[model samples]
Target: MIRLRTVEGDPPDVDALVGMYADFEADDRAQGIPPIGTDLIRGWLTGLEGIHVVADHRGEPVGHAVLVPVDGETLELAIFVHPDYQGATIGTRTLGELLDCGAAADATAVELHVERSNDAAIALYRKYGFTAEETRSMELRMRRPLVTPPVA
Candidate 1:
């Protein structure tokens, strides 16, 4: 069974999260993109609201997703699923939950920068209704309209 936990602060599973991201970077390098090493990931972690949501299976972290505010109305999402857990619909669910995070921030939209050549991720984003708003030779800028929460 898969479980999703909203981490209130730094997750206790930081090591596992970093390992998953490292594997993702290797995947990127395999497809001809620059390797995003631990330094970049570390820098990003520091600037983030230090929030994380972890997906676990049998007491082990299998996926991780984070939301980072980009501007007044935009939040950037980054997700990494352990390679062994790929193709299990985890990415789709993780992304959907990430989108929900925007609502809590009072965001009107969410955006993410993805490699133009990463067809798998592009398809996943499209499945979640994210549309390409702009593109460069190497990257695509995608956005999704946020779901507004009802006033309490």
Candidate 2:
């Protein structure tokens, strides 16, 4: 069974999450993400300053979703599901839990950039209400608004 939980109050399962990314194939990369090195992985995780969630199956991480603070009020969103666990409901659950926490944290909006060729990911983001704000080359920048905007 897959279980999803927020990474909080502790160091988090960094190794397990790293293992998931390390297992990724070249085709699974998104705009050159999940960078290819232990140092890079650790550095990326260490720099996160917002909500993060992980999906675990039998104590091994199979998916991860995070919302990192950017431009003060906006958060940058990212979600990854290990190839072995793709097509299951893990990504949806992980993203849902992270967004729930982000909302409670008063997130005004969250943004993500995904490759245009990745229809599956685009559909998933759209299902969560992310709309395109810009498109450059092969990447689309999408934003999901959580709170109402103030008057001009």
Candidate 3:
């Protein structure tokens, strides 16, 4: 069974999370992230600031999601699941939990950039209410409002 947990403040078990990213298939990377080398991945993960969630199976991280503050009311979102754990709803669950964390943080919106060629990721983001805001070269910028606008 997969269990989801929030990593509050300082990230815990970063080595384990790095291991998962290390094993991630290069072909699956989007927007040049989850950087290619161990040192790069470590640097990227450590520099991230905001809400974080980890999907663990038998105490090992198989998926990770984060919402980094972009501004006072918006956050940038990113999610990744290990290749071996893909297609098993790990991404779905991890995303849901991360969004919940975002809501708790009082963030009003979230945005992400995805490779245009990644149909599955685009579909998943759409399913969660992200709408295309712009298309830049080979990437699509998507955004979703976390708070409902008051009827005027």
Per residue, candidate 1 scores C-alpha lDDT tens digits across 1-152 of 99987764455465565555667646544323223777665555544573467889988778877776788888877776777888887878878777776677678888888888879999999988899999988899999889755799
Q: In candidate 2, how many Å is residue 53 off?
A: 0.4
Q: Scored by Cα lDDT, where does model 3 land?
A: 0.88
| Highest TM-score scorer | 3
Q: Regarding lDDT, does 1 or 2 come out ahead?
A: 2
Candidate 1 lDDT for residue 37: 75
RMSD of 1: 4.0
User: Candidate 3: TM-score?
Assistant: 0.94
Candidate 3 local lDDT, 35-142, one digit each (tens): 988899888888886788889999999888888899899999898889888898988888888888888889999999999998988999999999999999899999
Which candidate leads in lDDT? 3
The TM-score values for the models, in the order shown, are 0.78, 0.91, 0.94
Q: Please, what is the whole-model Cα lDDT of each candidate in the order they appear? A: 0.73, 0.84, 0.88
Q: What C-alpha lDDT, on a 0 to 100 scale, does residue 59 get in candidate 2?
A: 87
Give residue 143's lDDT in candidate 3 (0 to 100): 97
Model 3 regions more than 4 Å off: none
Q: How far is 91's C-alpha from truth in model 1 (Å)? A: 0.8
